[model samples]
Target: MTTKRCTMPFLRACAALAGVALIAGCASAPEGAAPKNSNGWVKDEVSDSYVFAYPLVLMDVSREAATGNAPGQAASNTLRNAQSLPPVGASSPPEPNLDTLVSTGWLDLGNEPVLISLPDTHGRYMDARALDMWTNVLWSTATPANERVNGLKAQTIAFVPAGWKGTLPARVKRIDVSTRYAWFIARIQTRGGADLNAVRRLQRGLRVAPLAAWDAHGKRAAQAEAQSGAGLSGDPVETGAPAARVAALDANGYFNRLALALEDNAPVPDDQHALKILGDIGVHPGDGAQLPSGSKDMAMVNAGLADGRTRVATPPSNLLAGNGWLWIGDDAGNYGPDYSLRAYAAWASPGLPTSRDEVRARVAQDSDGHALNGANRYVIHFSAKQLPPVRGFWSITAYTTDGALDGDAPVRIAFGDRNGARRNRDGSIDVHVSAERARGGSNWVPAPKGDFRLVLRMYAPKPQATDGSWQPAAVERQ
Candidate 1:
């Protein structure tokens, strides 16, 4: 005879968890919150109720973070309300043709540790970045390390991270993640362009403000939280050790404030509503003066007050950092292999190209001492005396959509000076990319079917390579 126990925690956790499943059912949700629901519940649960809900809490933040505002949204109005902003860093010089990648939302896992697992691309290890766009990461300690999985469709990936200590899989670098409550932010790293020197030079322009000041601000906010005591799951829930809880909330709050602050680059107006809400407890979306007094703004206010759906219940994605491994774009692209999964921490990166003109349209690198990605019909010709300036070694490779190495992968994959890649009579080297690499004979590297990416790695690069003096030829479709 078994007795069924009735419990409030159990019920709330179940409802909250079920809600999250609907949002980002893929990754792990708050520890115990899910009965099934996922994504949607997180943002709301956190925003409306501050109580700790498993997995959903993480899911909410990630969804919010990934759903970024359109660029230049609210530019005019924000400019009118603003004091000052950091100067725009030097924009890249116009390339023959530039492909711009706007910032998009990242996958969020609130408060749960997630592990991404993908095999080392048939052990090729190169070209992990291209696969990142279609990889799945698991949000559970139950999973293993530095691994990615597949759902047979290859669209969903199961990320396996063995422990909580690392950043991301050594093979996969960056992926956007945030909590509904998050305010802090992390951007994707830039690509390694042809001019290694210019890449390094461009990298120089980036800077970050200190966290100490942020800590002070967070402290103040936390103190305020203690006095007011917000609820969790829409019901008033008192925080234990109010001071500690407040500080934690403040840290998360500060991140919320930060995201709102950055809303106006080429700023569009559509995304402004969310940005305005960076607030004491929830996202406000109200700049007050700028909001139209006409019917629209009034309707907006009414919507927020009346429709529970209009309010953000989840914390921002940035807070999801602790729940699972978080990485940047460069890491995702495999520019720095094991950047997150491995013990990689540089004040900056070394893989950035030296010049803008010498950018590779796509590239890939692997831990198996190989580099791969889409060179589809496009070959980065390395003019001999100008071999890619990699200090450690180099290789060209190709992989499938989910970062798997394919036997029939197109192109000529080669790496290390040891391979008998024929140096032209003039000493110039040419890397030929084609769906049919075997036809090119010894120099060919095979590619998979469908869209692809590539990377050219030069470990221990030279002064010219790192200083913007040299540049790799861009990936050109033959």
Candidate 2:
């Protein structure tokens, strides 16, 4: 007989009954301790907790918002395709790539394993990634090098919970996830909107279903999970808009969410240190923050939350910085225990591809160190040899400081080989950046009216790109 796992709600109720007195006693640095030392410890705890929970909260909020009954909202456990590029000034995500049609969905792994089937791409550039509740990439088609050999072949992936005992088909690959919830993002390359039909055809070939809903013939079983309402149920938690959900979280709310997420998504062995820190501050897994109300400790917790937000927004020292560009090296998407780097990257560039599949360089200033303003034109001159080397392609996209596209331009704003970028007589390419169309023609990426940032994305980048041997030319003010 299978034992039933304790649910998050039940665990939370038990924690609440344990009371604040019990929590305070468990704190390593309790109130009335050394004022200076206590403050420092509290601050560190807040930062660590915030970084640890950023991805979890972000995923939860996004999943909730997307699964709502609204017109544009996508139901959970189903894939939603973006047919075209995001409109100008859209807040969905910054630096929207014009190269691919995006497909996104969330997975519910509470009942049984979910099977993801992919069709052979036949040399087409495409990747599907599965990120756990904490934002760690559990599985991706872009990794392990050999997976990309001979282009993408039709494959079956079964994502099961950790320690699950089941008999998977011999052909289907098994991926064990420690979390009950997972997010899916698939990017299929396209030359432009004209190539969208081909991408959509490939998109239709992708399928996701519960293990019970899968048949021995590798097809979906009819009327299996449908009657049980197993895979299609929406999340019980009511969540607001993604940004709003994040903004509305207070110290208590944030820790409570973190605690709840931990109940189901057990941390890896590497996270023991972080978990210990959180527990000392009364934010144990499955239990809410138990700090006493109107206490000095409570006040300190609030201050730490604010500071943690700032740190996540600021770039850490390890980010590769040169020529006015900032980027994570080969460790872009798969951050192990580097919570600070992971949190910061997620804040700056959400849904980043793994470094093997793509590396992004972002700059807000020109070569001379002045902020890039659309009113002042600039040029990114790539000499014949300086062009980004990639097995797939590269593009330079512009975004506002807040990570939104320039509102003035209706057309997709980017310049690259796939677009109509022109080469100079000397085999160099000059990409013009400005609000006004450049006289250079065909190589112009329209910037916003004010200060903006530029992202240089090298898809399927060559080894040199990530090996510290190749870097793009500096952006020069005109």
Candidate 3:
């Protein structure tokens, strides 16, 4: 909660960015005299502003990569489904989900409400969530608090824009979004390679259309659209890791993109304070402002940008940390004015669901606080009473330190309830994690040949899982 202060030189630089010679602060302070906290305040404010604008900028760039100048691109409001899982060692979207097939799209909600229709999976596990441009969860099928259910029945949802007066069909549910754009993501459980066809069938049943094109029953009235295979097209756009791309932007490029994004995705009520800070730095809703280019000015802004990146990459104070694991559950997916938490979540993994939907924990160190490596064998023993509490399922997957699936492993492996892990006679489950196989090979998770990390996913987690009453055991070195 560091505060921002205005200084004479910074104001002059801001005025320069706005293409104005002098602003209100010019007469207040004498030229060539630094204010009481000029350097410190500017650094703090610049870093804070960068964190505030991180999610919006990242989302805009990802959307551009998804829908612009790509071969076989799917337009906005069209679903592009993944027919299979990401390839081994794939790292584009860091920490890729290995337990489900994903179908995603961008929605243009400016003109009219977009319709998303999903088919019944007959009790199979599936969930869909829509996030506004700020990365807030607008609606999620996994949240029972919202009266939504996952894949139990055929459901039709309409994503309507704010302040739009419209009457959707009687059976269609409506979700109002504050931004002109939204991202929709849906996932269905997959057992393994054998479960691809069934998941694909369900994926094909997922549909998206504009409200104007839908009939009374939520089906598109246009015959041609219905026959277009539900907007399934070529492979999904690969934008290499978005976090890396965002980190590479200089102050000019970063602030310019933030200004452009703010035009479509207006700030929320709590965001006004941060917006005011940004305004002091010459960044406005629609102005692509530039930073001063003098040696000292450039050095100051670059230092601020570097600090912001470090802050976003650091784990927040409220994270759940135990047994060498760090994970966030509370205030996730619906962050309000917690810009640091929100920005870090977006940097770690965009489109994170709320705690009720899922809770993910990651541990990169052993019980002794040593970095996990394949050279040392390890085992995770879960007592019967301490097993992950979840209504849907749970899984633990290994990845390289950089967050990619281990391609060099002998086989693709994950262990959890869905994978049929073996239990000891004493009612405990021991999962062997190593490059070499453990005895019997029934509950072995293939580790990378080098340093690695483990992610534990608890889908539809129970209350104890997030309330600190239950936690996964520490990984013990053998």
Candidates in order have lDDT scores of 0.28, 0.72, 0.76
Model 1 lDDT, residue 287, Cα:
29
TM-score-best of 2 and 3 = 3
- Evaluated against the true structure, the overall lDDT of model 3 is 0.76
On residues 322-435, what C-alpha lDDT tens digit does candidate 1 reach at each position? 111111221212221121111111111111122211122234332232433343454545676567664334555443443334434322233334355766678777666655
**Model 2 quality (TM-score):** 0.85
Quote the positional error of residue 233 for candidate 2 in Å. 25
Candidate 1 to native Cα RMSD, angstroms? 24.5
Higher TM-score: candidate 1 or 3? 3
On lDDT, the stronger of 1 and 2 is: 2
What TM-score do all the candidates reach, one by one?
A: 0.28, 0.85, 0.88
Q: Which runs in model 1 stand beyond 4 Å of their true positions? A: 1-277, 280-378, 400-404, 407-418, 476-478
Poorest stretch of ten by lDDT in candidate 1:
75-84
> Model 2: runs farther than 4 Å from truth?
1-40, 144-151, 222-244, 292-294
Clashes of each: 144, 0, 0
